[model samples]
Target: MRKFIQSIMLLALSAQLFAQSSDWVYATMTHESALSLQSSHPSGIVILATEGNVSAVQIQHQLAPSLKSGNLHGPGYIYRTDAQDAVQALTKNAPKKFNILDFTITEDMFVNEVLGMVSQENLGNTILELENYGSRFHTTSSGRQAALDLKEKWQEMAQAANREDITVELFQHQLTQQRSVILTIPGTEVPNEIVVIGGHLDSGDWSLQTNAPGADDNASGIATMTETLRILLAKNFHPKRTVQIMAYAAEEIGLVGSNEIATQYNNQNKNVVAMAQFDMTNYNGSSVDVGLINDAQFTSSELNLFWVELMEHYNSTGEHRITYGTTACGYGCSDHVSWTENGYLASFPFESSFGEHNPFVHSEEDTFAAMNNDASHSVKFVKLALEFVIEIAKVSTMSTQELNKTDIQIVVQNRDLIYQFNSSNKSLNSMAIYDSSARNVLSKNQLNASGRISLQGIPSGYYIAVFKDNQGKSHSKKFLLK
Candidate 1:
């Protein structure tokens, strides 16, 4: 009851800041990047601060009650768009990125404090940032120019880091600045089919601030996403499908990064299966105590709920109460929105309660202290987010009906079954057929829209038909020859 009341108080205290939409937030972020060209050691110093411990299921569980309560101020509004922009957001965009300011600050504070770098000596100025982006173009030309300039600064910083031993160089996809990172623990029979876990690395601005250190805005997000990647990688268990972890870029600037990569795969029409986003998973507002709470409360129906259900495979957090699609919300700010917009079933793991939203996002204040913390189960929080990405996001979940709608359809001639299209999900496209040892069969081939082409002659016998679907989904069924 005390916690619930505290949550109400926090909401009442921060009502002014939490009312804005993500669209406004993105522009505000770019404004900050444009204003201050900080030289924080390496370019995109955001890359250097990675704790690799955000995936903790226990942590995720402890935060949900707060998430349910903090959703009041957020109405989960929707955005109206023209056909062109919708197409781009949903299809053409790919290669997203995840922000990690919260983790960075906490990790840095701890590391430095332990290293004896406390108040003794002066630490340099930290580059503050904020984010509310979904494909760089969502805002305006001003935002674009700002992003371009920020990129230039980061490039300069990254180049400088290259000269230093502390820098770890990684490739960024040319179009969206996205990086492809895959984690695979070999599958038993189908090592080719994969379950991908991912998040975009970027931030948005609501307005222009001189310093925009997106600590809670998304630094927390990337921290959780990366931590999830690390946990899955550390596990020795192998599943039926390979699990790939992708940290996308250009998410804040616009869902540009993830959209780019996802669209490319969509164009190829491969089975990307499902996608999940760890956007703002660090903050847990006050409404944690479930016993007492009035009608006025905040709630979050983001990707975390799905994650909670997914965790049932392991052991913990069995029930939750919130699941709103990105479209259900007004705008697509985070990278998961990119996947959802593109017609893919993607999830976003946002903060528990955004009531005490990050006031310092676009300013220099987006550091760790400005947001809420569940405190009890931080690691669990991170783990639940990833569990959803791995299980719910897997390709095998798709049904046979979804397969026929793709570029490839089932084709059968005589005793031969063939797949006539390409897809990323290997399980759906795995070929299956049955035939008797004494049966005589004729030749077969996949024709145009007509489907299967049979040879002139064939023998009567029982046989099974098999073929791959558009998303690389495969299926088989038995047939009686007459």
Candidate 2:
């Protein structure tokens, strides 16, 4: 009788998973029960997990009203997974590896050139158009149309620049009607390395058919990225590593769109150097101009530090000084969390402190006109995003090439690294071999007196040979292993 009951339970679970639809909701009595849903259903992804009572609006946006109205409240979890096979694969249940790159920005000239191109006028226009769409709720027709419009605008901008290397694509999420917009500019040298800057295009309120202009909530982020793209094209800046600008869909709906995309990238083993999220950038809610989310559990601190230093370097004139501070936005607060959950280095440069986030979000009141119709605050993020891409991706220029031109010659033969540097004892202190993903594969200290070092059993791919001389200065050269 016990064996028969077990079989019956298993059969019931299968039925629940396979029969899930858009409107279906799985309300678990306990946290353990909620996790079981992930294993059973294809789209059995968690949308909410609160210890205390949650707002009626929050429940209405993520859970079925009928179920919540029936008093199915939870200290457990709420899942909206119906048909999300791809998303399921990307979800990491435990801690994972974060791929870190070793590139540094030493070019002040290049940084200045990019910062000059940010335009408040252009950002203002982009925000105006997005707000005109009324609402961008994931399941609504208006949301779908906004995504399509964004894709076209990005494609046209790339075309006008005559950049054949840039490709604009729409990543479809089958569970929802809207698709994510991705603009990829392949690296001139290291095409495998990637840097991502993104914002959600979809916005929402309690009423799906009503207005949710979302000017500060996210249209600001999208417009900032768009203006950043325009500046990159105008300057003809081609980076050594690929840079992608993404406008995610359904971010307001539990980060649904970005989670799917990040999962796919992880499954493909793509080497993403860093990802920056710009959500709610227009409103100057806090005294500080920029808020770097210090969510240690959800963001990369190393990258956050880099943002601070970069802003400091540009703030010498005081006019562009971005008064900034750090604060946490909790887990899964924005789309950047999606990438962080997938073991990627992601950072969120939020607009204000969490407590001070625009109260107009997720409402019809979220319009540019409502924020006093100013783009100055949002422009700071636009400049930062632009610099973040160029610096992290590292544009290929004559100066960079010249810096790598040294007497040290490196060659690879028979899966071994051959190097020759004069006066290895006093001049050279240590040598290290790093893979394209910036993982240190091998290290050696105190070179031989002959000044010739040969390493064996190296894998076939592009590698960076970094040598630190007595002066404490490091120089890196890229070599291919056949």
Best by lDDT: 2
**TM-scores for every predicted model:** 0.42, 0.70
Count of clashing residue pairs in every prediction: 82, 2
Worst 10 residues of 2 by lDDT: 51-60
User: Model 1 residue 285 lDDT?
Assistant: 43
**lDDT digits (tens) for residues 305-329 of candidate 1:** 2332232223222222222111122
TM-score of 1: 0.42
Model 2: per-residue lDDT, tens digit, 44-88? 344333222221011122432122222211112222353232123
Q: Clashes in model 2: which pairs? A: 43-81, 44-81
Residue 82 shift from truth in candidate 1, angstroms: 12
Shift in Å, residue 80, candidate 1: 15
